[model samples]
Target: MVEKSKELKEKEQKILSNKTQSIYALALLIGFCIVINIIFSFVNFKIDLTEEKRFTLTPSTVQMLNGLKDNIYVEVLLEGQFPAGFKRLQESTKDLLDQFRSESPYVQYRFFDPLALVTVAEKNNRIKDLAEDGIKPTNLRVMEENESTEKIIYPVAVVKFGSKSIPVNLLENSIAGFSDEEVLNQSINLLEYKIADAINKILRVQKPTIAITKGHGESKPIETQDLINTLSPFYNLKWISLDSMYTVPDDIKLIIMPNPSVKFDEKAKFVLDQFVMKGGDVMFLINRLKIDMDSLRNVRAEYVPIENDVNLEDMFFKYGVRIQPNLILDLECSKIPLVVGKLGTGAQTELFKWYYAPLLSSNSINPIVKNIDRVNAYWTSTVDTIKTKTDIKKTVLLSSSQYSRVQFAPVRINFEILRYDPDPSKFNKPNQPVAVLLEGKFPSLYENRVSPDMLKTLTDIKAEYKSSGDEAKILVVSYGKLINNLYNPTQSDYMPMGYNTFEKQLYGNKDFVINAIEYMFDEKGILAARAKEVKLRLLDTVKIKNERSFWQFINVLLPISLLGLGALFFNILRKRKFAS
Candidate 1:
C-alpha cells in the first residue's frame, strides 16, 4: 500500500509537468501569431464600444450602410492641426464608423494628411461639397509666432463607402472650421434618413404626405413656397384650401392654418373641428393681433387695439392656449438696415428693426429643436398660458428673453423711435411664450353630439360653453409668419417695402414652420426625414493634422501602450501562482 502511494504521487508530478509544458507551448504559439498579425495586418483592428449590441443597426444607418455597392472608404483629411471641437468629433466618428464597419463588412476608413499630401490635398473637392450640404466647421485657430500669425489650413475627411464617396471639408469657409463633433452628431441624428435614402436608391418606397389647409382663408399653396421647399424633399406635398370646392384627402396628415384672414363659416369651422376630432394634428398660425411695424420716418406706425382677432379666441381657449392680442418685443430685435446719409450711399444704418420680426433665442431643448440654433421670427405675437382641463402635457418650445415685453397691435413704436424716455424696465422679463407645443387628450368640439343641420351650417356656430367629455387635441403656437411671408420691415424711401420673393427666402423661419407642422402631425415619422446639418462636414486641414497627431501621439497611443504593457506583465505573474 505504501509503495503504491509513492507511485501515485510520482504520476501526479509528471501530469503537472506536462501541463506546464503545454501552457508554455500555447503561450509561444499565441505570441508568434500576435507578432505575425501585427506585421502583416494592413488595416488596424479598431474596436467600437459605443453600443452594447452588435449586428443591429438603426434604420437610417442601415440604409446608409447598404448604400455601399463597393466598399465605402472614409479619409480623415487634416493638415498641421485641427480645431478644438474636431478632436471630439473625430473620436465620436471613429466610434460610430468602427461600429458601422462591424455591421458593414465592406466599409473602410483612412486618414489623409492634406499637408503631407499637398498634390492630393488641393485637388480634393469633397470638403467644399460638404459645406454645400450644410455641415460647416467650427471656429478657426490662428497660430501666432514672433508677432506674426498665419492661419493653418485643416484638411477635410473623405469617405468612400462602396460606390458612394463622401468628403467632409473642415478647414475652409472660414465661418466654420473643424466641426467634426457637429458633423458627427448631425450624422448620427440623421442616421435613419441617410439609411432611408440609401435604401430607397437600393429599394424604392412611397414618400410620406404633407398637407396645408385651405378654403378657410389659409395661405395658398403658392404662398407657402418657402415651407414647401423645406418639406418637399422629405415628403409628398399636397394642398387643401377648404374653400368648399373639394373634400379633404384621406391621406392628409398635417393641416396647416397660416393666418387665415377670412373667418371660417359654419362648414369651414366644422371641417377644421372634424379634422381635429378625428385625431388629426393641427398647427395654427393665426394672427393674434394684426401688426405692421411703424415706418422708420413716421416715428408713429398704425396702432389698433385688436378687439377680436379673426374669431379664434374661443377656439384657442378650448385648446388651453391664450393667443393674446398683444405683440412680443424682444430687447433683442433683429437688426435692420436703414437708408442713412440721405438714401444713396447705402451706408446701411441698423436699428432695433421690428418687421413684426423678433430675433429670439431657443428656450426648450426638446428633440425638435435640440441642436437647432437661434430662431428669428417676424411680426410674431405673444402666446400666453396653455390651460387644459385634464391630463394634458404642455411644453413651451420657444420663448422671448428676460428683456421682452408686449404692446397691443398695431404698435405705435417705429424705426425712428430710439429708446424709451425712462428706464426700459418693462422690456426685460423672465420668460415670455413665443411658441408652445401642447400634447395629450383634448375635449372634442362635437362631444355633445353634432346636429346634422349644424354640420351643414358651416358658418357662424358659436358653441363657446359646450364641453366634450373626453377627446384629446394638440395646439401649436405661432404668429402669422409661420404660414406666409407677406411683411417686410423696411422702406425704400416711401416705396412701401414688401417681400415679392417668397416665404422660403427667409432663413430658418421656413424650417421652423414645417418642423412644427410635422410635430403636430406626429405620424409616419415625417420629422425624422432629414438631418439638421447632415449633408456634409467641413474641417480645417491645417488645424486638424496638428491636433490629431498631437492628441493621439501624446494622449491616446502613449496611455494605451503603457496600459497594455502593464496588463501583459500582470497576466504573466498571475499565471505563476507563487512567483516572487
Candidate 2:
C-alpha cells in the first residue's frame, strides 16, 4: 500500500512538471512571435507569383512611390454591385493601391459607388456633382433576373495631392469591336498607366510648354483637338507660327511640325535650325507622298498620289533621317468599307483591306513604343536613317510588317486593287521604318549656306550661329494623320484619336503620341510604367460548363461531410477515454 501511494504521488509530480514546461514553452513562443513581428515591421518584402508579374510593381513605380513628398488621397468610384469582370478590376485596383500603401505610408485610397443611394433623385444629384467635378460615367450592362439591363456607373477616380486633383478613368474601352472580356483585360492592363499619369500630373511643379506649328498647312485645331485635350492636362499647348517669329519662344521647349502642305520658307527653316541649335526638341510628322482621300467622294472611288512640296528634305538629311517620297503598302492593313455592288437605292458595302492604310507595328523595345500594339497610319512614307557626320543615336520606333512593299513616287493609287487579292511576290520589303527618334548634336543645315547677316536677322543678336547643336531630341514620322481625330457631324463631337468607327476599335495612336511626349520629358522614367504588361489568364468556358455540376457538388457538400466525420471521430475518442 505504501508503494502504491508513492507511485500515485510521483505521477502527480510528473503531471505538474509537464504543466510547468508547457507554460514556459507557450511564453517563449509568444516572445518569439513578437520579435518576428517587430523585425518584419521594418522590412519591405514581397513575393509575386503571377506569370506576368501583375502584382510586382515596376522599378519606375517603386522609384516614384519612394520619392513621394506628400500624401495622396485616392477615391475610386468603382463600387457597389458589378459583374465579375468589373469585380476583377476592382480587386486589381485594390491590390495596386495596397502595394502603393505598403511601399509608402503616404498613399491612401477608398472605393465609393456614386450611385449607391436609396432614391433616383439622390443618384441623379450625385451624378451631376460628379460630372461637374470632371468625373464622367460609363454605361455598364448588368445582368439581372433572366435579363440584362444597362446601368450608368462612374468608373473613375480622383487623386488629390495637396491642392491639386486629377481624374483617372478606370475603364479603358477601345472604340473597337472587342468583346467585354477583352475590354476588361485592356482596362486591367492600363490601370498602372492611368494611376501613374495622374500622380505625375498632380506632382508636377510647373507644366512644360509645347508649340503646335501652324500657318504651314497643318491640320486645323478641330482636327487635332483630341490630341490637344490629352496634352492640355500635362503641358501648356500654344499655336505658334514660324512665319511671324524670328526666333522660337524661350518658353517653348518642343515644336510639333504637323503635316505641312506648303513649303517651308528659307527663313522658317533657318529659325527651326537655330531652335535645334539652342537645344529644343522637335517632332516632324510629315509625309512626302500626299494621297488625297477626299477625291473618293466623287462617285467612283479613286485617287492619285501627289508629292508634297514641303521642301524640308535637305534639312532632314542634315538631321540624319530622310522621309522618303514613297507610300508604304502593307498586306497587314486596316479594313475599310468598300461598295461591292448597288442595293435598292443604296450600296452594298463590305470591309476590305485598305492597302494604303498600313497597320504599323511597334516592334521596338524602346521605352517609347515598347509593348504598344499597332498604330494606325494612312499613306505613310518610309523613314530611312542615313549615315551622317554627327554621332546620332537613331532608334526606330515604328515599322511595317514583313509583308509590305514601298511604292515609289508618281505611282497611281487605284482603289480597284481592293477587289483583288494582293500578290505576295510584289510585297518583298520587310520591316520598313515608319517612325524614328534621333538624339544627338545635329549639324546645322545652314552651317555654310546662311551668311552672318542672315543668321543674325533670324536669331538673337547675342546668339552665334552654331554649326553643330547641343544634344537634342527629334522624332521624324512619315505620316501625320496619326494625331487627327474623326469628327461626327450628327453628334457635333470629335471621336478619340485612332478610333475606327466601323471596327469600333481604338488604335494605338493616342497611346503612341502620349508616350512620345512622355519620353521626351521623362527625366525620372515615370513613362516607362506604361510598358508593364499583365498577362490575362482566363478560364476556359467549355471546361467550366462541362464540370460545373461536379464542382458545385464538391464545393457545397465536401466541407460539411469532412466536418461531420471529424466530429464523429472526436466523439468516439472522447467516449473511449472516459470509459477507460
Among all candidates shown, the one with the greatest TM-score: 2
Clash list (residue pairs), candidate 2: 175-504, 175-505, 176-504, 176-505
For candidate 1, give the lDDT of residue 408: 70
lDDT of each candidate versus the true structure: 0.55, 0.85
- Candidate 1 residue lDDT tens string, 407-462: 77555545444443324676765457877776666675555666766645534443
Name the regions of candidate 1 deviating beyond 4 angstroms.
Answer: 1-94, 97-204, 215-217, 220-223, 245-247, 294-302, 305-308, 339-348, 353-356, 409-411, 419-424, 454-475, 483-507, 517-580
Best by lDDT: 2
- Per-residue accuracy of model 2 over 30-82 as CA lDDT, tens digit each: 99999999998899777888778888878878888888977999999888888
Please provide TM-scores, in order, for all candidate models, with all chains considered together: 0.62, 0.85
RMSD of each: 9.8, 4.3
Cα lDDT of model 2 overall?
0.85
